[model samples]
Target chain A: MERIPILKLHDLLLVTIQVDMHDRLAMTLQDDLMHQIRRTRARGVLIDISALDLVDSFIGRLIGEIASMARVMDAETVLVGMQPAVAITLVELGLSLGGVRTALNVERGMQLLREGSPEEEASGHASIDH
Target chain B: MPASTIERLQVACEEDLVRVRQRVRTMAAEIGLSLVNQTKIVTAASELARNMLKYGGGGETEFERVERNGLIGLQLTFRDSGPGIENIEMAMTDGYTTGGGMGLGLSGSKRLVNDFAIQSAPGQGTTVTVIRWK
Candidate 1:
């Protein structure tokens, strides 16, 4: 059983999706991500899909589910490094990953996670900015 | 002019969906489709292949290289012999799924390509054909 490695960096979990994942592998990723969250108690998750050439509806739904699951577990999930084509395909596939926050790249994604919610930063709520 | 066959593959199980995406990408790239175009078609193929396996109980896929009017394109057809769609109108609608999916298989695939055709009847199975021009 090939497994997707879940790396922990401080309070964040980083996942890079590089393969054309099969159904079982997707399920395994979800299960493992959940367990890792419980064990590491990470505050944020960053999923990089830049290398993924194709992501179907099943995978799309699973991503949405992952974000929701992370949210329930007291963590925020941000997806980054999505190619332009993947964004278009996801829209056509009827998946916007509504709850999953997105960034242009891992740099921005990491920034988003390091602090807190982007919404909070946007509304001038969090006054911890230097 | 008849489209030339590029490749063929089996969609017998879940893993076959990955094969479908891989083959679709290879043929799309062979046809010189842009990266965005290749991703769109491959994504569409992925959704359709999964539909065939999960609902149609397995099927086969054929890839074709189409050239017409100085434009090149890639075409794919998926055929299955399991239970067919009971109502295509409803099935084609977004957010309709009989197999616990997000119901993006039909309508979404249609949006990804330039040409789309689907034929199905209850208990007679389903066949979907799609084409994307480069």
Candidate 2:
């Protein structure tokens, strides 16, 4: 019944995970983000997990799935603002979060998304950087 | 040498699982565990609590403040009375799951703590105990 709000910033979708999400809540977030992507036709997704104190394998897998799903929808997903302790714990927990792009913070994540695909930029789409 | 009971919780659903993690974090911090250690213990608690709820059909968690050899530590015990695991070895192996999960709960949680123990059988339920020194 509870939902995490997804904000749309132009061609990007911004999500800040501020609560200690339950399993169903995390699953709902994944479902909601996918639908929003299709509806808004966003080009990128920025997920801020800075507020999350713990990311167990369930949440970790959902994040990976969200990234993979977003890629299939032609959108980039960047995870941002992981705490140093969380990063260490995640590695020890044996979750590499492989194939998920990450940034130090929201600003860097937005910049990474704005940079566009390497091939797209190489083809002179760099001038359209917003 | 002696341990003090800190808190006890009933973990039956997602909300309880969140409470388990938060309580573990708070207790870990109260015992002066470093930030990294607190994160590790809390993550481990999250994994084990979810396993109890999902696979074990809910369970009980007990937090203890333990002192061994003059070192203060936090100890957690999770007990469940649902369907017991048939093969704990396979379950403890990474990427092994009977419940359509990533299967990192048991094995991964073990790695995050200093001491870990588990007991289960085909008909009997499961009990997992872990301790992290500060």
Candidate 3:
């Protein structure tokens, strides 16, 4: 077990997950983050995955699902700091992340969320476009 | 290294996915895989395990270490005796998951690892092998 680190910003919340990106932990974190969104009604979310070495279909789908749930709650979700290899693999595997927003880094994602409109941020639709 | 270092794990149904994944993670780490490699192996294993439980009924997972040309790698084999796939080529195609959820498991898992192989027939079963080098 590891200490899950979460940071709250003005309107965006950042979660730093330290555990290996396995199915159980990913699903648990996704559930907890959604619960937090429903409870706090935060405007946006930034997931810092620079520490994550791998991103698979299950985790990718879970992230997309959480983003969709957040949208229903009127919040936005952005995946930040994806590794180059992970990004390429996700694209190659055809994991459809239709409605989820992504950024090169958390700082950039936060800036995009702060500057972009809800409509733009809400673009993460639940489709397997890939 | 000795063959004793290799670990074999078995699980039944979706309930055992977590345990199977944990076992694979531990073995991957013992092989000295980097964080990135570890993530890829774990995710790939999860995708296969899910398919085994959901589509294949139940199955066994084996974890072993392989060395080639002075390089070490981790190998995982997922085998199930459930209903086999009819069109393996089509199933490998993107967005073609028969069970649902974006249908990204096969293709996604393939891309996450260094080596990927799948064997299946209508009446037999499905066997998937994935490997990643350290």
Candidate 4:
């Protein structure tokens, strides 16, 4: 079973989707992400989809679910680097991803996570207390 | 002087879905389609393939490079030999779904292509064909 690598950058967790995703991999990433969020007690999650060229309803729903799950577990999710064509097709497919925030790239996503987190007001560390 | 080639694939499970998408991307790129065009067709393929897996239990997909009326096109046909859709009009409805899906599979795939057609009967099977031009 291939797992999506999760990188922890201080208080933000980043998962860049570099491979073309399948249903199982998508589901696995969802589970792994949830566990990492709770274990790390992170303040934000950044999912970079720059490498993903195609996204369907299942993958789209998985993404939305990740955002919702992360929110429930006390974190904000920012999705970045969606391709123009993927964006167009997703809108037509009726998956709005209302729960997740959008960013242009990973750098911007990192900035958003840092600024959006409530813990950012403190010692630059979004610990379990927040 | 190049000859049109066709590729066939099975869309039965999760892995198949990914393979079909990858195959479509390669085929579309080979046809000299733009990035946006390639992505559109691949996304549409994913939706239709999932529909076939969920509703029809499994299906076959065919890809062929076509040239019609001076338009170079990539066409895909998905066929399922399972419980066929009785009402395509209702199935094509934006919010209508037989399975636990958004019901955008058929309609969305239709919108992403230059040409679309479907043939099915209650007991026969379902065949959805779509073409995107480059």
If ranked by DockQ, best first, what sequence of candidates would result? 2, 1, 4, 3
The positional error of residue A71 in candidate 1, measured at the CA in angstroms, is 0.4
lDDT per residue for candidate 2 within B1-134, as digits (tens), equals 44365689999779998889888998999999999999999999999999999888999999999998889999999999988989889999999999898889999999999999999998799999999999
Query: For model 4, what TM-score is found for chain B?
Result: 0.96
- State how far residue A75 of model 3 sits from its true place (Å): 2.3
Each candidate's interface RMSD (Å, one decimal) is 1.0, 0.7, 3.6, 1.3
lDDT of 3 by residue, B9-73 (tens): 67675457777777877888888987667767787888888888889888888888898778888
CAPRI grade of model 4: medium
- In angstroms, give how far residue B125 of model 2 lies from its true place: 0.2
- Winner by lDDT between candidate 2 and candidate 1: 2
Estimate every model's Cα lDDT from 0 to 1. Answer: 0.88, 0.92, 0.78, 0.87
Ranking by TM-score: 2, 1, 4, 3
The candidate maximizing lDDT is 2
lDDT of 3: 0.78
- Clashes by residue pair, model 3: A99-A124, A99-A125, A100-A124
Q: Which stretches of candidate 4 lie over 4 Å from their true place?
A: A117-130, B1-3
Give the per-residue lDDT of model 4 (tens digit) for B49-85: 8888888899999999999878898999999998898
Candidate 2 lDDT by residue in tens digits, A1-130: 7999999988899999999998889999999999999999888999999987788899999999999999999889999999999999999999999989999999999999888788967876432344
How many backbone clashes does every candidate have?
Answer: 0, 1, 3, 0
Structural similarity to truth (TM-score) of each candidate = 0.92, 0.95, 0.73, 0.92
